[model samples]
Target chain A: MAEAVDVAGLVDRARDGEPRAVARLISLVERGSTALPEVAAALAPHTGNALVVGITGAPGVGKSTSTNALVRAYRAEGKRVAVIAVDPSSPFSGGALLGDRVRMGDHATDPGVFIRSMATRGHLGGLSWATPQALRVLDAVGFDVVLVETVGVGQSEVEVVALADTTLVLLAPGMGDGIQAAKAGILEIADVFVVNKADRDGADQTARDLKYMISLGRRDRSGPSWRAPVVKTVAARAEGLDRVVAAIDEHRAWMTEHGELAGRRLRRAAAEIEAIAVERVRTRFPAADELAARVVEGELDPFTAAEKLISGSLGE
Target chain B: MAEAVDVAGLVDRARDGEPRAVARLISLVERGSTALPEVAAALAPHTGNALVVGITGAPGVGKSTSTNALVRAYRAEGKRVAVIAVDPSSPFSGGALLGDRVRMGDHATDPGVFIRSMATRGHLGGLSWATPQALRVLDAVGFDVVLVETVGVGQSEVEVVALADTTLVLLAPGMGDGIQAAKAGILEIADVFVVNKADRDGADQTARDLKYMISLGRRDRSGPSWRAPVVKTVAARAEGLDRVVAAIDEHRAWMTEHGELAGRRLRRAAAEIEAIAVERVRTRFPAADELAARVVEGELDPFTAAEKLISGSLGE
Candidate 1:
């Protein structure tokens, strides 16, 4: 499979903004193909230009509608946009959720917009391993902006924070989202917060709740700490989207000013490198099954078995 | 910390059912302390005796209440039980959910019962890494049954499945739990279906929905397959508790009869060993930050940086 992929030609086509070529490249990344090294090497020099934004919220927090609106907002500025909707809960491949896809129909025929949905069904490292590679593909292919939207369940919200240059944590009124967000540990990662469906009954209350929580936690760092702004939006009508976009841009500007953008990107790269390297080492230890059998039979402990596996494979 | 630990002495005390010794051993595991290898070595040869049961469900599904009832039922059978309540969402250490700890007050003073709450917090491998070690500590300490109850959010339900000999997927009536469970990709991992809060309306409908989903997928494997039994209970009042216990025992018996028990344990051990090996490899790559900086500066790609880090460390 690796031998069949013409990495250079595909990279060239992707650079030229051929959507098919871009899709194929992302497929390779998503599948964690053996030709990834070649693909990455080919795409390296042209990367790092796109502004990566991550939008995440719980299942009913209007993430898809918000993403659709954000895509339209970015396109109005004549910026080419790419959207990667990630479903950490769904393990199936090649199929996006039907409802979300229908809502995104506005972008189906637009040449300036690219939208793809990915599921981490059988991937061992989950989003930590695959999403960055997909981001790298979109970044290298000349998309001016890339938005990663993930279902905010479990650890995916935290993982998305690592992948984005700016993260938008979406909430809706009367859902007790403020408490849920804090309990899920996502409140600290937000560069900007969007209270979508702001026309709801308790929109002001939710916004006030978030501001109160922010104030309690905000002693401010020694340096200028970016205060996560809360913006209200009725995404279905595309209302309050300009402020959302402006808030995102302001956050990006703040990150650049603090040199925090480079620092975050560096940390993301480090994590990506560590995941790949660890996966490589794991595959080298083919005696895992036999060792595991010993462990099951109580003949060896797992830690000792792991140590033996490592030494046998790495000759350490 | 490792140098100060008397691993052998702690193991000896733990084997004698000293609660303090057992607590210390679990603390070491939870902290991923340097003494882990010593602790594992000490615990080996005395492990694999306990029946590991995993109970999981979404928030407000009565996981803690169900667990509380299960503890009472097992105690009635004169079997020693150890409950590990894992909250993957909370990152706090030395602090369990206060409400859950209060709910288990019935067993707090029972000499034969031990209950502990763990949070992933800063732990890199999450439940996959720590929960198994905690189980080993309890198993080696002579518990007849170890119940691993986790908050079923995100990827945790799947992870808990990997750790249990028999997994009970809990749901409540009137919550559209059937569809929610299916979407969360948890329906397949359940070895036993639990519809708690059976006194509520739609309990029978929920049970029917589960049975229908189960029937659609159950064509019987190549051999005799153990069909997951949906057991209903009003755990708050302890109504129908006996049936839930019976279902769990029956599932365990069926797994043993089919030799599936050994197979599950083998797979679990393999995963545990792999997590440890991967974590060790991750620690050896100290040049990651420097390489990541270069990648962030657009001088190198992450894949190539990973390759260099691997080869430089492993000399492969």
Candidate 2:
């Protein structure tokens, strides 16, 4: 662990667009370092510039292939690309979980590309605590686009939408992933739908199912409802990727026009801040450990235990 | 909210095999009622008699249909049964999610059957926070078997294993769910594996995949190794259902001889009690809202904000 004041030099290098510095900063966040406050403060000015995109779906959904294709398209437009792949199962950047990123080796030599795979060391914070700070590191390091890929439809993955200007939910044909999309409430979280492996037998039906499920979703009536367009693609072949990128751009444009781009960032920042605050308060609650024992012994109940914990944890 | 004394009466009736009392008690647990301590005290003696089984897998895996089948099997053995279906997507129980449970109408008129569909009510507790207490309510009311089911393979769903005496992970062929099971760390969480829709093409291959994956998991070195037996079942047709039940019985017998079942229950009780205490403590933390504002403003980093929140909230 570095001293709080010492992290500023690392932050300076990170902001100056040094890949090693950027990697070092993200590593600190992943490890839940004590000097995190220093890092966040130093990098604060450099964030809020990059376009953050989140890609998530069930495993084996060609999310990696789609991400690779999308990265190529973005780089063709001369954009600096950074990808943060969050795999909760892997505590470290183990080899097996990140086979796709290995396939992403095509981007390795390109100075315009930076990729980092993160596993949360199996902590309680999971994605909510680690990801935002990692995104901040990417944002601060001057990437034009930061792409996030997460697996599963759990609430943690859904929170990935908060960090993105647009969220691409990848599905495939013949796997019942479309019905999965509905059951996981992916219909509500997706900003754009990408049906990968579209050359398969039931691709059309999968697309139709997603469209129908999206129709049944409770629309956001705050303004004109943006219908999530379902697009089919053969990501392994890089076919239909141009259409996917076009959808991303159009969604980004819509976000800009409707002021949703700013709104998303604001909410993301707010959630990150709240998560941090609640976590910090957690340790200070007096008798939490003691009350827990009492509850286990049947001497107290949990809700009342919580109420007492709050009172004892708080100062006048 | 019922009065504390009134809840005692409800607990008594609940113990006396009253359905309305059982329903009211569970409702209180689900609503996170304030009289939780009183309820816990009353129900404490009646628990520890029920066996909890957690059924989890990805969506479209025929979990609910299979649960229905398993319930009928247990009821045939003259066992009273209760089901807790944990679906985070349904904020309120409505639509496609709970539809299968309704289809379990074969046991609808059985006086010995009780069923609950829980959707987390969009709370921070996720699955770990709610299910244990609900299990207690059912346990108090004298259900010999309490079956818990959860969707998806996210880490949260994996935590459901801690609450069950035996955790049954369901998978089907052709959905890529076998690979999904490996990816979501389901290989390690499953105590008994049910290959539902086993009559479908590639069911044999799917079973082979699970067997291979389980063999690959790092064996628990603390005791005699338990090899999670993979059982193929056409659950809808009720074929091979007896084999699945036999596997569960064998596992329970092994747990009993090894003292693992008691250990599992002790840990479950500890966790439920601790969660209640922590949840109660959360509300009393001082100036959490204030610190969250400072974090959003970038005036304070989350780590420092948490440190401050704890210090401010803690009493002398």
- Candidate closest to the true structure, highest lDDT: 1
- With a 3 Å backbone cut-off (N, CA, C), the pairs that clash in candidate 2 are A280-B306, A306-B280, A306-B281, A307-B280, A313-B313, A313-B314, A314-B313
Docking class of 1: acceptable
lDDT of 1 by residue, B1-316 (tens): 4557889898999899899899999988988889998899878799899999999887888988888888999999999999999876565643585745685678667889999888966775888899999999999999999999987566776788899999998889986656666777767888999999988999999999988888876765566888999999999998877998899889989999999999999999999998997787677667668888878877788878877776665232
Give the CA lDDT, 0 to 100, for residue B85 in model 1: 90
The two-chain DockQ for each candidate, comma-separated, is 0.44, 0.19
lDDT by residue for model 2 (A169-200), tens: 88888767566778887888889999999999
Residues forming the 10-long window of minimal summed lDDT in candidate 2 chain B? B307-316
Candidate 1 chain B has its poorest 10 consecutive residues by lDDT at: B307-316
Lowest summed lDDT across 10 adjacent residues in model 2 chain A is found at: A307-316
lDDT of each candidate versus the true structure: 0.85, 0.77
DockQ, prediction 2: 0.19
Task: Report, for candidate 2, the interface RMSD.
Answer: 4.6
